[model samples]
Target chain A: MTSYIHGEIETPVGPLPRIATKWTHLDRWGALKTRWSVGRMKYRVRPGIYAVGNPDRDSRVFVTGNFKLSFDHLRRNLEGLNCWILVIDTKGINVWCAAGKGSFGTKEVVRRIRIHHLAQLVDQRKLILPQLSAPGVSAHEVRKMTGFTVVYGPVLARDIRAFLDAGLKASDEMRQVNFPLFERLKLIPVDIFYGKQYMLIVPLVFLALSGLNPQGYSFDLALNSGWKPVVNLFSGYLAGCALTPALLPWIPFRRFSIKGVVTGWFVAVPLLLAGTLGISLMEKVSWFLMMGGLSSFMAMNFTGSTTFTSLSGVQKEMKTALPAQIAMASLGLAGWIITRFIFI
Target chain B: MNRFVYLTDVVTLELDVTKCTGCRMCLVVCPHAVFGIENKRAVILNKDLCMECGACAKNCPEGAINVKSGVGCAAGIINGLLRGTEPTCDCGEGSSSCC
Candidate 1:
């Protein structure tokens, strides 16, 4: 274990814990672990002031949330620059989410400034905050309370060096948020991992229900009949969670639920056609309903991962989509029951 | 963003041009480049690009901007529905108990 105090870097304010911008073996391992587990929710640092590189009182001060990943990303990008980092306690949340939640608001920033006696340490009375943090922080209010001007920095930390070099004026490109393919792809793990519990429950319930048919409750019959429904359910999962996000921009509709339905049909139609060669028409209809509804439900969940939809917009979508999803799934279940008991 | 375009005309973002001081604060804070300064006033360059994060409205000294700002995540919304509350992102620093 690396001692937390192993290499204390000295600063004008005081000696503080230091870390390198480059990823260590431990960091790589942590990243892998976090990808699989709920570690992003738990990974955090003690919120306080820290120094990056050897710095005098004149060094710039940057503020951010205490989520270790957010902290690490910020510091790593500042490799050779001597600066001061004042971390606020957002309970391990990142800058963007924390700012929306009020944890990264005016009060916390003022409190951290006062507690750290930052005014005495830095000659400049200015704080550079992540642009995303602007929502919860009023620059005018911060100036009024702390006597320090808040300069909203670029949206991404990687642009900080250029932002500073250009006299703290961000270019148009620095302010834009880009959801490129890689960024979209990285979110897939979290989406799949978070949905795991529900994924397990849905399939098991479908399997158990498959056994309650008129023919017999034999495990062999259950396995034979249950496989198709289970496959259909998971097909929806793959369509909604995996395929939808990967092809997000290319997908047809603006609403994520609609996109999921479109993608779900793409996957479900082929599967239904392949598996229902000898099945009854009622069973086929049930499969179609289940596939569409499940896919839509799963796809609607992607609204959280997307960048464009607003809260009200999402609410509007759920208002329209949820009831239809419930009705379709319910009717599909009814059809399955009827086909097993009456048509069999 | 130019690379991706979300639902157009859906965001409830509005700007009072008369109230805008043309300080370009909205241009500075917005992650989506949703605003542009034209003729000493802020204009919606690409209204469809607005993510409704509210960074611009919060930072606007003139109070010229209005947006219903909140997290846009769906899991949070569904959780809110089940719990009888407004949907919110709690992945970090949020008040919601669920992640």
Candidate 2:
């Protein structure tokens, strides 16, 4: 219900809502909260027309999704500038994802433009859209449907000011998407958070399986036999989910599965050496195989977060690696069960 | 981008210079700077950098660009494998696979 009033204007969609030019502390806090929250489903705004800095008929109109973070970034970056903010109902998805899904698309843009009476509010027939939204929005179609021309702004909202100041010309740097170490590392928490259930489930299953002995269900016997398998499983999970992503570039593998296996081995070797004194050779080999497979699977999951992987490439990797991973982990688990129950 | 290169020779993006109008729409829409303008024609500058999001191909008016673009997330791929369909990034689709 928050509104900003710079000037009175009538629209086919009703009265235009107003927004502040300056972003407040609450906005920043909301952004931070949403970043850590699961799925960010609650972080969204009502979609419609909004004004910033007392925009007039000559002001530039910018289009964005109703995801609060996207909206906040767009508006906050435009502080001290007068412009028309046209938000599309994207069901809380961000511009890039929504664009891919076709929610932030030509039809929606044209509909919003007509409903908001944007042509009458702005003298210029240009609508600035986020560059990432290009996939969903066809400029030619927008122009054909509505008189407004679509001018793709910079890839990042922070560069919007510079792009606008330079007459809407984007530099090479503005166009590039940089996925730095910090950015990659920040994404780890969410990945780890989402994988938490599996993290707990896998080790607990291993522990339960390891505890079943010829002597029956004895807690002490289970604790003795199951602890190593639990540790190895957890180690593999962390190696795949956390270590592989952190050392993505330096991990010495073109494939994520390989990188994960390498990381898993890196962790497993020390544990293997430290814990091998009393355990059978089959048990040691089983731990190595299980850890390697588990880590590889976990690391492969990270392909979704990386900026370089393609859909085909991931499928290709999965085709080759997934079967190998399944074989290794399966054989290793079979070895462990045989050693604990039959050999012991 | 220079600091940490993820994978090489995986992108399917290509530019047909003969059909390119040099409108620079590819340059404008590509977040990875995969395309560059030379002699008023588009060229693939960094093919490896492409994530295949399909923005350039979608925005190209002359139909000079081609790429098999889609979300490159593994969760989406896994979901697709389970469902026996083409993988789509879960970020947009109300799925638990994405954050």
Candidate 3:
């Protein structure tokens, strides 16, 4: 209803807001900001009917969620096609995710069609839904309730043209959800920020604890040695939130937890070999445990962003990995603390 | 070729081929290409490839496909363990990004 909406168009549903297929600088900027978790929750478009181009009753109606990003993708893909865009209220969630949550679902689709008098506005009895929404919507049921057939579109908005050109048929690639490098990279920023609030506080606690030793506390040692743990911690975080996800496919483990540990050591071992962790064997081993444990946990949590991990598979992985990660971190932290208290 | 595959022999996705009715709804909705039509009936072609998002089960009018589907996120699982509820990314605050 802001910059995107240009004019008003009248239909059987009454005067409806019109949006363009153009992308402004602000629109692209909003996408970038949201990628980095800025103003993420509030990034929404008012859910209702939106007209893209001078659409008539015969123009195809494309449905999407209220999330502005979802709307942007759908509209941007609609380039030359004139269509009526129906934005469903999914509480600012993207279509695929909302569909998974059952918000962008059969009930909502039917509800929106009824409330907006979509049947009267469109000449055709078809609603083009994103294929991902099939998880929440029963196409047969929608047809039964709304008297309109649901034709599922491609998984990616970019493939809309191909889908439409193929007589509303989707290719195997169009239906497949991809997790390429760029997509994985784009998702890393938000995950890195997921534990960001704890970033400073956690390191500061270690810094404070660094001053302890057999001869009591020493600020000099804290300044000199504390930075090493800080580095290890940050490197572990980077490996978990960035490296593990970015190199997900290449890593040699089916379990994300183990993959995290692998990537964690891949980065941490270099620092350990450089003798930056500590001089003592206890300190060196403890850093590996802390770093690997932290990274493994963060990487495991990244199962949400992946495209192909199943619920049962993840649950199975978490069963043993979660306990192991906890024990490793706890034992490592306790060992590191004890090393400070005694000269061994 | 299987670079994208997850844990093997772990997915619960099952196909009752008798009741399939060969609608191909499962074939169309599965993001992992887990289903294929064999002899005009749906077959579980790649069972391990199933992320079990439940798209096939929900869209199947014949009720032939069944997979205990839910969010696969570890944070969602931990949250579920804490709350004693089903795995969900919809918990209040902080988890907004999870879903």
Candidate 4:
């Protein structure tokens, strides 16, 4: 009775890495995309109850939104903790976002609880939830429906151990949400990813416009023509994506768009003044229009990240500000073209 | 930090004081100091300075806070809107399709 041995698997005595091999720091587009058998993080996951730690009926249960990133962060941070992790699919969005959209609301929690047979698995009717999951989850409603008392956990998963140790209560600092420089910076990649889409289009349009000139401009002129628009495009990108985010808290403004505009203007000032020193009126107007367009356009983007803007507020801005910026850019393009053919 | 009031009157982030509790959580978390204590309750003193990160709402114990939380970038919002769903980017909302 010789049993065939499978390939020898290398082993380490120490605990395996807390994170799965797929987990990595979030890139410019949120967490980097993964190709695994589990179908990756952001996919629409099946809703169910999972165990962070196997336990009898007395183990504590934690509730989380089904957004894979949220679940991943929680599970990764939990490390050695033993508890039952209940995940309610909010259609693959994080707790905070799901809460805002109501996918993480009371009915879903109760439904998941009943569907997952949570009552039979655990003796206690307590569920620890991420603090940000409150918007859609009506505590009163969940209690009425499922009889489980909801205890709000800290904003970050790293503090969960301390919270459970302290009698299921969040410490003062645990309750506070800090948007530190690194935290704010973490969002830059997503911003850059989205911005890149627009960035790709803007320059291409300007390049075509440069070649549209009928005066048969020299190759040097055509080549140089793109240089300014390129600078303008980068300046605008920096204004909205990099500068606005990095200096967010200190930008001396309320509306993110306005703050973005101010930031763009600040960067644009030196260049604008420098470009205008000996340039013609056509160039000067074109420069001003470009600056105005880029500044406003960059600032307009600040609406989504900042605290001051509203849905209606942003819509209104897009309505009024967008046209103005586009008009300015068009004016600049028109002026540049006219200067190329009619005047210069 | 008080360089210019660029966001002045551009956006309004208001907290319904009737719903507020003096948790003092918003105080510690805000990067912009947009909130302050007034008579034991949190007030949006510098409301215009808010980045709408949903941190205060998340930390508020009473469920009394509300905010339009999403990305502050234009491209992010436009992209969200084009998808025909809510635009929350705490990695929480369903932007997983973008993944």
The TM-score leader among the candidates is 3
**Residue by residue across A118-163, what tens digits does model 1's lDDT show?**
9988889889999889878988789999999999889889999899
Pairwise TM-score winner, candidates 2 and 3: 3
Model 3 Cα lDDT, one tens digit per residue, A1-344: 38988889988879999887989998999999999988888888988898888899899999999888989999999987788998898888878778878888999999999998998898899889999888889999999998999999999998999989999999998889889999999999989998878888999999988989999999998988788788889999899989999999899978999999999999988998877677788988888898899999999988998988889999999999999999889888988998998852
Preferred candidate (TM-score higher): 2 or 4 = 2
On lDDT, the candidate that comes out on top is 3
Candidate 3 — what's its lDDT? 0.88
**Model 4's lDDT to the true fold?**
0.62
lDDT of 2: 0.80
The candidate maximizing DockQ is 3
Tens-digit per-residue lDDT, B14-94, candidate 1: 999999989988888888778888998999988877778888888898999999888777778776777787776655333
Which segments of model 2 are wrong by more than 4 Å?
Answer: A1-14, A21-26, A196-199, A223-228, A273-278, A342-344, B1-10, B91-94, B97-99
Ranking by lDDT: 3, 2, 1, 4
Per the 3 Å backbone cut-off, how many clashing residue pairs does candidate 1 have?
2
Per residue, candidate 4 scores C-alpha lDDT tens digits across A1-344 of 10111122211221211122133444212444432212334444356755553344676777888666677677776666656678897877657656656678778889988877788767888988887776566665677778898777887888888888888777766755455678666555555555444676877766655554456756655476666666766776677667787887787745565666677667767766756311567766675576657666765664454333445456655766777778887897678767656553
Compare candidates 3 and 4 on DockQ and give the better one.
Answer: 3
Tell me the TM-score of each prediction against the true structure.
Answer: 0.92, 0.90, 0.97, 0.71
Residue ranges of candidate 4 with Cα displaced over 4 Å: A1-46, A196-198, A212-214, A217-220, A223-225, A269-279, A307-320, B1-99
Worst 10 residues of 3 chain A by lDDT: A272-281
In the range A1-344, model 2's lDDT, one tens digit per residue, is 24323454554445676676566777767777666655477677887788777778788999999888899889889988878899998878878778876788899999988876787777889999998899899898899899899998888899998998899888888877777788788777666765766767777787787666676666776677677777777788889988998988888978899999999989998887878312788878887888899899889988877766777688778889999999999998888888767655
RMSD of 2: 2.9
Runs in model 1 with CA error above 4 Å? A1-6, A9-14, A276-278, B1-3, B90-99
